[model samples]
Each structure stands twice: as structure tokens, then as C-alpha cells.
Target: MKGRESGMPEEDYWQSFFDADGVVETLFDAAGVAGDLVEFGCGYGTFTLPAARCTRGVVTALDIEPLMVARVRQKAEAQALHNVRAEIRDFVSQGTGLVSATQSHAMIFNLLHLEQPLALLREAHRTLHCGGTVAVMHWRSDVPTPRGPSLDIRPRPEQCQAWLYAVGFTDIRQVDVQAFSPYHFALLATR
Candidate 1:
């Protein structure tokens, strides 16, 4: 149950397209996220490392790609970040394997464009504690991005909000992340 291909460029090339610090900062700020966090599709540890450093609790990063998981684990180890748990997991099929009502926040970065977006959003809702946050980001449909899924499949912010609402999330608000990456937009939803 691996997600659809991200259509990303090489690691360095894809990483070069984003201001990682700015994106991570804006995401956490918009979500009011703290405590334990779960990140889905943490490719190349772009956001995972910063999140591990920022949170007092653990940051569990899950990816279907073993290479991606290993890269994140390597970065966490190099940084001596004991709070990170980078595991190769097909959460899309097996679920998060995290206890319900346990995680304070869930991150679905660059992944909502998958074939089963609602299913993933439902999983995010289930994993979070009451009043917990669900942060989602995708390539902005309005602009041409250096690399991302086709525009026909890329979700708009409003569509994401509607899906979150359908999954029992509330307080859904758009976060202005254009400063971080002009091609991306983000939203924060509460469960």
C-alpha cells in the first residue's frame, strides 16, 4: 500500500527547492503543534529533523520507502537526536500502529495527493488526541512547481479542508506558507 510516486527529483535537487526551516517553522506554528508528532512520508528527513529538534516529545517518521526511512534515521543519529523514530512502514495499509488519542500532532506533508487521500486523513484523525492538530501541505495547484504530481491530481487547499471536515476534523484553517515555498500551501485541522 505504498503511496503513489511523489514524482520528486533527485534528493539534492528536490531538497534544494524548499526552504526547509521556513516550511517546518510555518507548519508547526500554524498547527500549534507540540509534544509527540507523527510524520507520514518524511522523505529525505527534510521536515523530520527540524521537528525532532523542536518538539519535547518523540517524532515518529514513517515512510514506505526503506531508503527514505534509513536516510531519516541516519540524519537523526548524526544529530544525536534520540527523540526520533524513523521506521519503514506502510501506514497506508497497516495503519500507523500508534495508539489512538496518543499523538499530539500528525503531519501529512506532500502526500495528500495520493489515490486514497481521505483514508489517510481519516487515519490522521484517528491517531490524534482530542484537540490535536493535523497539518497538511501539498504543492500549490495555482503555480507550476519544480517537481510534484500533475496539476490535474494536485489538491487545492479548499479540497483538503473539505476532506478534513468530512473526516471529523474541525478548526481547519489555511496557513500562509508561500514564503517558505511559493509552490506549496498548507492547512491546519483539529481533531
Candidate 2:
């Protein structure tokens, strides 16, 4: 549940937090998704729309917020996208379609800050297909900053790298994404 105090319209305010198109552009161009694909913390089709444009496989866009799911569904319908599907499921508590039926790849943006980054990484590892890429996007500094500088608590690139390692993610790579203004960073952790 997105607490009312969060002070943002679930999509209008929250979707603006990231340059989803830019990040998804990077992922698509980088050959990030090699198999079944999904996105964690997908809000309002921000990243989901672009991701849907690129991949031929099914793209399961997930979020914990039901309103966010509805908003994303509206956007997807407005855009006439048939490939992307929105669902409400906690990334850790529910199936991510990463491990259950089969292993899958995922792009997790701006989600790790919600809970322990290490636990998410471990779950990502468990659900992802072999050689899957888990893209983690967050801010560059944990200190007070302009972008996503929330008590909601986001991690810097260094912390993401270290956490990925701690969670047993191999071949960790951090990249600066210029798509999101105010400078957002993304880490690619593969198993």
C-alpha cells in the first residue's frame, strides 16, 4: 500500500520519479532481456510501455499498489499495448514469474529502497533464469539529494554493487543513466 503520506498521486507524481523510457531504452539497447521478461515495481506503465515495445516475449509488469496497477492498465489500454500485462503482487511475497513455472529475467527500478536491498537481490536470484540480468536502478547518493531523496530510503550505486555481491550476484556492473534527469544510476547483476 502506498501510504497516503507519501504525498504523490500514485502515477502522476510517482511515475515522474524516473525517466522510465530512457532506462528502458538503455535496457533494450543493452541486450538486457534474453528470455522471459518482467519488471518489478512497475508503476503506471512508465517503464512497462517501453519495455513492451522492445521484447518479443511476454513482459509481466508488477507492482504492489492496486491503484498503480489500474493506472498502468489504463495507460496500456490508451497506448493500445497488448504485450504488457499489469498485476498486483509483492515482489518477495508473491511469484515474480522468475523461478516458479520457469526462470525469467527482470528489470527492477527504484524498488529496492522499499525493503532490504539484499533480500530483493536474493529473491531476484532465486526467480531469475540462469544468465538472467537483474537491473537495479536507484540514486547515486544516500545523502540528502533532489531526486528520490526520500525517507523511503534509496541506495547509492556503491551500496547496490556491494549488496548484489552479498546476495551472490556475479558479474555486477554499474552504469550511469542519463535518461533520467538529476542523474539516476542503474546496476546490472547477473547470475
Candidate 3:
């Protein structure tokens, strides 16, 4: 199923809001994002290519939109990034088709405002091995952002942490991503 509308801006406009490579480096370095990684909503391959460069293992990038999946695939091919696997799938409704406990890290960036936040977290939990990390990022509600979901639906950092904890994630700590994405807050949790 499609997720709740995030008020996503046009691709270029949305892309302008983040320094994708820098944000990826910061979050991945802190979370030890190695081995195979799974990215939820790999829109425009913004983070997928950067992540592929970081890990030796495959980067499984899933998105519900076929255009997004195709875009990621094209970019990966153009860059000769043989490690990326871009697929069109509704990961929110159907869990990621990865073997349980097989992923080293999962990226749930800017997607927590969905209808079932816990369900998504649980899926991430189910797919990750023990000690595997999940990185969560979302727009900060306190600040007026250029783009994001409605303020009422936007989750606070504490709420995201609580959901992570509820799904059995540990070592949950906020990471400073303001340098790259000043409008967003990031959290890293271990499964």
C-alpha cells in the first residue's frame, strides 16, 4: 500500500534540501553501515549511490514507485555500481523480501510518518541480524521546513525513539545530522 502523503516536493526541490553524500557518510559511519544494506524509499537514488560506494556488500534499494526503482537502476548502471539492487515493491505492506537477520543495516529515512510506524519498524527489526543497525531520519517538526508532511502528522524524535524501542531496538541514540540536513533529525538503533 502507498504510504501517507509526505508532501514531498518536486525531485529537484526535494534534492536541494539534503547533501545526500554527506548525510549518508555521517549516518553510515556512526551506525557502522557495512555488509548488505536495505534502503526504504530509495527516491531518485539520492542515498542509494552514496551508500553503494560505502559498503562492499549489496545495497538493496526498494521503493513503491517503479519510476524511482528505474531511476536508481539507471544511475547505478551509469556509475558501474554493480552492488546496487533496485526493486519496485510496497515494502510497507509487504515486508522486504530479504532473509531474516541477513541485513547489516536498514535505512528508513523520512518515512516514519506512515500510517503504521511500528509495523515498519517491526519489519526492519525482523530483517536485521542481532546488533545490526537501523537508521531513522525525519523532518524536524519544531522548525519550519521547506518541505515535509503536515506538522500534526510529523513525529518528534522522542516518538521515533519510543517506536524503535518498542520494536526491540537497542542502542538507540540521536545522531547529529544538522550539518548536512538541518531540517531533519536522525536516530540510529541496533536490532
Candidate 4:
């Protein structure tokens, strides 16, 4: 199924909003993101390529848009990031198509505003190995941002925390991402 539109900006404009490398580095370090990682909505591979570099195991990047998936794959190949596996998949409805308890970490950036966030969080919980972590990032609703979904639809950190708890995630804590992604907030939960 096609996911709800996120009001994603143009590629270059979207890219300008983030320091992908710094955000990835800070979040991964805090979450101890290692081993195989699963990224939801790998738009432009902004985080995917950097994530692949951080882990020895594969980075499985799934997106509903074929163009986004293709772009990610192209970038991965150009960077010779052999560990990246970019594929077009409706992960929200079909799940990640990964073996249970196989992934060490999961990335769900700028996506919780979707209609069924708990479903996606459940899938992330299902894919993670015991003690594995899931990182969630969303545009800050408190401040006006250059781009992002409408503030009315954006989920707050507290709301996201509740959803994570509902999906059987533990050790939920906020990670400060202001230095790298000033317009966003992040949370890390363990499964």
C-alpha cells in the first residue's frame, strides 16, 4: 500500500535541512547502532550511506517510492557501500520482510505522522534482536521549520514515547539531536 504523503520537500532542499553525517554519527553513537540496520523511508540515502559506513553488517533500506529506492541504491553503489541493500517496499503494511530478531537497530526518521504509527513501531520492535535499539526522529513542532509535514500532524516526543511503549519497546529516552538537526528531536528505545 502507498503510505500517506509526508509533504517531503525536493531532494536538494530536503538535504539542506540536515547534516546527515553528523546526525547519523551522534544518533548511532548514542544508540550503539551496530550490526545490521533497517531504515524506514530511506529518502535519498541521506542517512543510509552514513549508516552503512558505521556498521559492518548490512543496512537494509526500505522505501515505498521506487524513485527513492533507486536513488539510494545508485548512491550506495557509487560510494561502494556493498553492505547497503536498498529496496522498494511498503513496509508499513507488509512489514520489513526480515527475519525476526535479526536486526541490531532500526531508523524511523521523519515518519511517525503516518496514520498508523504503532503498526510501524511494532514492526521495528519485531525486527530487532533482544536489546536492539530503534531511533526515532521527527521535525520539531515547537519551532517553525523550513520544511516538514504540517505541525498539526506531527507527533510530539511524548506521543512517540507512548507509541514505542505500546509496541513493547523499553529503555525509551530522548536523544538530543539539536546540534546536528536543529529542527528535529530524537528518541531511542530498546527491544
Candidate 5:
């Protein structure tokens, strides 16, 4: 299941919507994440390359689109980031293709509005090692975002929290990420 339409913009235009480093710093720092990271959707390598550089562990970046996966791989190679492994995968339907309890952290940025958010969250939970963190960011439903799924389908902070809880994540809390991007909100949960 591909989930609802992402309403994503073109590559260059969508890349402009974020200051990749700033967003990555805020989310990763807030989560106190370390070690290997698994990203559910590596669109344009917006967060993947930066994350690979920031951590001592590998970044397994998965995307449903081959173009997106190839883009991430190109960025990683251009940046000389040997730790990033970009894969073309239908993670939404088939899961991350990573072993359970093998990753130290997971990044689910800008992807929580899927039709089966719980399925993805559970997959994240299963992949993460005990005590590992999952950092989630999504378009803020309260505000009119420049580019995101419509408010009708976007998951609010509260709704995201509930879904996280249902997936057996603990210590779930919202992070203040206004400085990173006004259009998005972040949550950190532990497995």
C-alpha cells in the first residue's frame, strides 16, 4: 500500500522547502539518537546524507520510488558518504527489509500521513533495538503548509501520538521544531 498521495513537489522545489541540515539537527538532537539509522522515505536524500554524516553508524535509506532511491545513492556517493545504503523498496507494503532489533534509530520524517500509519510505525518499532528511538516529523495540520497532503488527510500531532502509543512505543513526546520549519512538527518515541 502506497498510502495516500504525498502531494510532494518536484525534486528541486521540494528540496527548497527544507533546510536539510537544520531539520535533521533538530529532530536527531531532540531524540538523542545515535548509531545506525533507518529512514522510511529518502526523498531526494534531504535528510539521508546529513544523517549519514552525523552518525557513526550506517543510514539505510529506503524509498518506494526507484528515482528517489537512485537520487539518494547519488548524493551519498557525491558526498563520499560510504555509510549510506539506499534501496528501492515498497517499504509501505513490504516493510523496511531490515532485520528486527538491528537498528539503533529510525527516521520517519514527512511520512506519517500514510493510509496505514500504524503498519509503518510497527515496522519501525520492530527494526529498532530495545531503547532505540524513532524520530517522526510530518506536516503540521494546524497550519496551511506550502506542500503536503491536504489538511483533510494530514495527521495532527495528537493523532500521531495516539498511533505511536498503539504501536507500543514508549516515552513518546512532541519536540519543539519551529526553528527548523514552521510547516512541520516532530515527535520522538522509543521502542
Candidate 6:
């Protein structure tokens, strides 16, 4: 963490992320956590904190960047959320294995636009129990943002659904919410 900057400008984008058309409502609906829930890119704990508040199990907020990890930790601490935790983890790990019996739900917003999401999705796949849920959403249309990565890698609803299907997730489909204008699709896949 030596050369790490104080904070990321990405945190500012979250100010509007929860305000997006139907995003916040969908997040609220994502309530009702049964067991351990994992958020892949839990930026600043916007969704993580709420999901934790709604659930009873541990919330593992994993991000690749150390700065992002620190940011989420700060947010969790500021809110006095005792069950949430954050860690720095690359999408791909060389070798390791451990999974618990408890089920876990997952949320991925504006995160599927990465250059390689499958590798991380595979890790997620390994960590979930049967009947676990995964929610993935990306920008509906490409909007230029210097602060964020290129969204050219985004997947359509159908594509996301198919990807989930290919990854062994059952009940894979899109959640039709009013939050999206042209409508950004969020694919829900059950483990």
C-alpha cells in the first residue's frame, strides 16, 4: 500500500449510482439475505452496507485494488456495520481452495464491463452454495467516462444470461426493473 493514493475518484460516481433510475429500488429488493453474501467489486460499500444491513451473514467485499479495499473498509466502519469485511483480491488466483456450507448471494453492478469478468465469475462460482443468487448490471449504453474504464466490454441481458447458464448457474435470466432508461439489464443467476 506504499504508493497508494488517498482515495479514488470512482467513489464520486457512486453518489449517482444509487440514484440511477431503478438501481436503488433493485438494491432494496435485493434485501433478505439468508447467509454469507459476497459482492465482487464492493466500491465504497454503497450496496454492501445495505445488503449487510438487510442480511444476517458475513458480507465479503473483494476488490482488486488496495485503494478500493480501503475505501470500502472506511465506509463500513463509518456506518458501524460490524458484519461487513473488505479485502484485496485479484480476479485470478494461482492456486487455493476452500468453501463453506453456508449459501451466499452476489451483486455485480457496473462491474461486468471489465476486460475479463469470467475469471472472477469462476471464482465466485466456486464460493457459492446451491440456490445462491448473482445479480449483474452494466451501463445500458456506452457513455464516455474518463474516470471509469471503457465500457465496450459490456454484455447484453441475453449475453449475461447465457454466460451464467454456461457457468452452471440455474434459473438464469434478466430482472426487468424500471430503473434503466433504454433499460440496463441485470442478469440474475442462481447457484
Q: What stretches of model 1 exceed 4 Å from their correct place?
A: none
lDDT of 5 by residue, 1-191 (tens): 66677545788888777777888888778777788989998878888988987898999998888888888888888889999999988887789889899999999888887888999999999999999999888888777778888778888889989999999999999888788677888889999
* Preferred candidate (lDDT higher): 3 or 4: 3
Error of 5 at 100 (Å): 0.7
- Considering only N, C-alpha and C atoms within 3 Å, which residue pairs clash in candidate 5? none
The 10-residue segment of model 6 with minimum total lDDT is 1-10
Which runs in model 2 stand beyond 4 Å of their true positions? 1-18, 95-98, 101-104, 142-145, 149-152
Q: Name the candidate that leads on lDDT.
A: 3
Q: Every model's Cα RMSD, please?
A: 1.1, 3.0, 1.0, 0.9, 1.2, 4.5
Runs with alpha carbons beyond 4 Å of true place in candidate 6? 1-10, 20-32, 94-101, 142-151, 180-183
lDDT of 4 by residue, 1-191 (tens): 65466646678988888898899999889988779989998888888998998889999999988899999999999889999999999987789999999999999999888888999999999999999999999989999888777777889999999999998999999998898899999999999
Model 4: residue 34 alpha-carbon error in angstroms: 1.8
TM-score of 4: 0.97
What is the overall TM-score of model 3 with all chains considered together? 0.97
Q: What is the TM-score of each candidate against the true structure?
A: 0.96, 0.82, 0.97, 0.97, 0.96, 0.78
For each candidate, the alpha-carbon lDDT, in order, equals 0.87, 0.69, 0.91, 0.90, 0.86, 0.63
Better of 2 and 6 by lDDT: 2
Q: Distance (Å) between predicted and true CA of 28, model 4?
A: 1.0
